[model samples]
Target: MARIAIIFLTFVCVFGGATFVKSIEEDFIRLPLTSLHSRSRRKADVVDPNAKKVNLWNDRNLQYGINITVGTPPQPFILHLDTGSADVWVPSVNGDCPYLCKAVNKYDSSKSSTYKEIPGKTFTLGYETGGLSGSVAEETISFAGLEIKNQVIGIGENQDTDLNSYPLDGIIGFPWSGATSQTDPKSTILGNLHKNGHIKKRFACLKLHQVNEQPGGELLLGGCDVEAEHWGRVYGNGYWEIPIDKVEAFGTDGNSLDSICGPGSSVPDCRATFDTGAAVIGGPSYLIDPIASKLGASKYDENINDYIVDCDDQTLGNLEFTFGKFKVVMTPGDYLSKDGNTCTLGFARLDDLSALLLGDPFLRKVTLLMNQEKDEAGLAKSNIDKPVARPT
Candidate 1:
């Protein structure tokens, strides 16, 4: 009952109350995301620094993969490249999956000739624990090397039992085109490769990789890696939004000691969704009950409804979230996590105070681009600067 690290992503559900902040029709380019504190030995660069990359693997940071191939003479699988999903599924050898789709490889479509079968449609999905109910075809997927013909997949058939525990045999929603539940709202595979032009720039860039390191994150499609320093630029309505502008509780010189939500309260200007499937940082419950009672964290003990915190007083103060004039800080080792000492407190609660998903413990500490050509969204700090190879 008390665990706090959810990632689900299919339709999104979590409920509680209070956290609103929506109304930015578009127009934000502010920078200075705290300059990520500065650190440069120089040499890092990106602005297409060769673009085309698709390497990700990490499953211990909880999830991240990319192997894909799909249908018509393709096959292969792996997936989970979800930027919080938008469509592109798996687990179909005619459905009936169980052992978490058994190490995932399925998707026969009778061996594919480019599958195709969006007839009576079915497609369910949804996961915070379960639900798949598939069948909704149209294949020819591919990845990184690029090649996305028909797209719109799904397949499953019936699932639950926690999809067998996931070893990865599904999920590939790079989020965009009508944003998932797929029945073909433009087929999203990068919006059918930017509507047939095959991408001149529609944007996509994510890096995430830390806990054990070797996954060497990478997902740049279309273009953007432009790193060199603590990047910035925010604005959304297209998904990747940010403008929390306040969350509060900080001391030890960090300042702010009050206001747990934002602006004039009552859930006003709060916004927070970055949703890489949402690993945790939900919101509402009057903004996580006063930042979990000034970080002493308790209540929610329905045995394990979770709120523990004390992994050594979780870094001793500082939680900030500002986002419009920058700020972004999160010390306490960034929200707290520790299994043996039993820490837990990445913040959770939700009913939707307008928006607040910010998942993956605040996106594995930054480095995201998502600029659907001017719709804007870029954040910095996670740049180890390695991508620049593709050019066969």
Candidate 2:
């Protein structure tokens, strides 16, 4: 869903202490997200002894997720619900992997009566952070209170260092493109629920909190509570889609900032996909360069191919954008990752990608309601409200 950058070693201090954070007026299920960094190597050119003859992944300072249940009796483990890529997988307990994967949760087929092996099928997933290698198998996976039967999943036999020290046991793919191989052609787990008449609608809402110990927000599988006061006006429902009407940057003094694209000019108004899985905002260099300069962000560092910034600078104004009629502004806290004195810009340049990507940094300020059936997405300013019950 998003790209990763090589993280430089820096001391981390909790800028904001713990709090019971709320998400856009409590219209969705509340899930917790934590900031994580990997103390692993970044190169994939050399083969890793722990990874079996396969390409590895690398990176740092990303999001870590919560526990999910799999198997008949329900074995719970932490898994990343990534909308960017599809394929539900976990590390293999039987794998002879490196010490890096020693802390990961593995699946044991023999422990679950519902588990079945799909012989001769291997599953491998590559990401900026690392790679995962395993086999295809069938098992039951449940979310909230809904359950899907005989779901295809990948079991990891090998994992590279990028995946090491992660607080995740596996990953669950939740997008339209949800298959790992041609042998299987089916909608994602949530999609299947809607198709099989399990859910009333093919929709989900995600509201992620800022850094906190106890956060509020959840993946609403059936859809958001339109009855709820905070449910923003639905714009596009297909995939949280929005048009980038224009881009603007503000200096520390709230004045108009300059960029290579010129001042306040529309940058083609490219399409942007709102993704919870991506940690950084990505677009063409032409669009991002001016923003970096205005923020006083540092030039590109070849070591990471990204702009690192001064984390402690708070005088900057919000990086604003026009989405349809909505005005979305990203404050310094939203666009800057400040850990001690080591600060970095949340922007990543992907000149090759035509669509501008609004990752967690943007999603953090808005509520994303996605309706898979209609292929549309809705955005609205988050409102704080009384706590709501989570879907079981």
Candidate 3:
């Protein structure tokens, strides 16, 4: 599968009305999320020994992340919780490149008692915009109150401008272990946790809140939350991809326009991966072009490689995607991004990708449950009212 390069501008708009304030009764491990723009810090009220609440930082509505400690004394680094790829890496303090590595936290192996070097082993991951090249090493990783001993991790010696530009320290990929290039499947964090009996269930739930909302989101490990209203089975081995039956557009007339990507459409059997790392939706030009045109987006801008739409357009309605019997809808507010005075359609063109990539634009509207063990995913209208609590 080809890696899709992601491009997005920082935009601001309040969607989904006011934040839902509901109490969670279930007991599940909760990792609290903090917005990058938020100046105040809210503490989680519920506390459990098995439940760890880490501060997940939302970076300008583009990436959601959490802090993890590596090595013996537990050197902390804020890492992007990315579901699109599989690999864990942090910049090395000893790396020759100082410009990029100095911007964020770096791991120094010599300072840790548990750090183990995997000599001659190296890893490389390429994205559409940036890439990372590093050496393989092993250390104890502490996350969400669990310790993954001897977890394989990458020590970045070289970094790209795109990767270093972000405020994040590194990335913690959530894709299947086999999708990783740096280590054996058994060495991946999720793989090691399940193999070592650290987590009873091999499932996780992702809840991403609106950028303006406090406690940006929560990542629940071990089980799905009860808030979900819809469910869908996932396909493919590497990505958490679900079948997309068809896509329909609605105009101001409140009537459905012609649909695309079904049995009789130009493209059928379309699938999409929910990528937490990405900020915008990406799809083949065939699918994105029609949607953009119907939404009144201007001709494609070669400079940004995206279509621009009027920020005040009132005729834009909704885009609905069907997966089997479950349907997920994105209102104009969800698909349009406002950057300063210019508004751009949130969808991008990735002609070479086999499946559509649904990023933050789609994620923020729903609660997603991913069961890696069963290769299934569930979706629900996002009703995040409180911090996620561990199941008792």
Candidate 4:
């Protein structure tokens, strides 16, 4: 959720030290780039627009960061699946948004008989590149038959500018204070859903992909998607957490490289996290050669953290992990399909040390079902091999 400096500045004074929002009104106050809306203009109180109409819309995308297939035209969008931020926004008919962001045909609040302005819910988003300032107001929100009453949405200013390469309307975040703390950054989508009871005792599922022109890519909630559930019962780990089995190293000669594993050292452990937002398979560089050797796999560089492989090259193909007694395995086809003929793949040195973020490539192989209330995520083998769920 990239809010302009003003929004962040406002937060500094509020949650900065000891200020949780004093009032609902103070939550989204900001200085607009122009005098379009008076600073003194009050924000609107969100009302349940759907008290009248029921939308059949399904899987609306969360703007910014996270990538998913949202809304009509059904284009895949990257949104901020954050628990730290709130408000679901996407490009509108304003023709002012760019970077592959297309406006969604949302209901006009003006037409909603129940619409009411709480007065003063506008904000500005600041990103590393540019910024967007807008007003926050009440609006209709729904997807896959799941609807929330009086959802708070941000109405970004219709300005022209290129801020970041990844573009979208808004971020999906929830008011939460979970694993995030003063020492670490915070996010809260799960927390918010738990607050609203949208999710069961509290966890969600994510079945994301890296924007390919294929079917069966998405992030699920509460229950698992048909395709993602192809395997078996989903498993849960601490949200975004994984287990450490072992860690080793290798040299340029492709043999086992000698290294030390320690509690505080980077190269010494196999503990890692599973973040769907990331792009590539990242972890320690040292493990690359060693793991490949252990599997007897061949690698041909692709100039990036990727390569071409001969899937059936007699390498100790396929990798496996067991959480409890359940076995979740990554087959030869699961590594990274570089040579489709024999099922070959490749890897990249993620952090030079430490575990990889384990992004889309891996997520699609399994289902990450996080329990919001419990703050744990379950990992189950994907039924990807099933007849109905197989990719088209």
* TM-score, model 4 to reference: 0.50
CA displacement after TM-score superposition, residue 369 of candidate 4 (Å): 2.3
- For model 1, residues 61-166, the per-residue Cα lDDT tens digits are 5556677788779887776666656666677776664443454467778878888898899776655455667778777876655678777777776876454324
- Answer with 2 or 3, whichever has the higher TM-score: 3
Model 1: CA > 4 A from native:
1-38, 49-69, 73-89, 97-108, 114-140, 143-145, 148-158, 162-169, 173-204, 207-219, 222-225, 228-275, 281-293, 301-327, 330-361, 369-392
What is the alpha-carbon RMSD of candidate 4 to the true structure?
15.9
Stretches of candidate 2 off by over 4 Å are 2-61, 64-66, 179-185, 226-241, 258-266, 385-392
Q: State how far residue 358 of model 1 sits from its true place (Å).
A: 8.6
lDDT of each residue in 263-379, candidate 3, tens digit only: 777786788788886788888888888777665565687676678777776776678888655577787767676667877777788787767788987888777777666566767
Candidate 3 achieves a global lDDT of 0.66
Query: How well does each candidate superpose onto the true structure, as a TM-score?
Result: 0.36, 0.74, 0.82, 0.50
The runs of at least 3 residues in candidate 3 whose Cα sits more than 4 Å from the true structure, single-residue gaps closed, are 1-6, 9-55, 96-99, 185-187, 227-231, 385-392
C-alpha-based local distance difference test score of model 2:
0.55
lDDT per residue for candidate 2 within 37-116, as digits (tens), equals: 11122221111122111001111325435445679787766566555545677767786556324634667777898998
- What shift in Å separates residue 21 of candidate 3 from its native position after superposition? 26
The candidate that wins on TM-score is 3
Candidate 2 all-Cα RMSD:
12.6
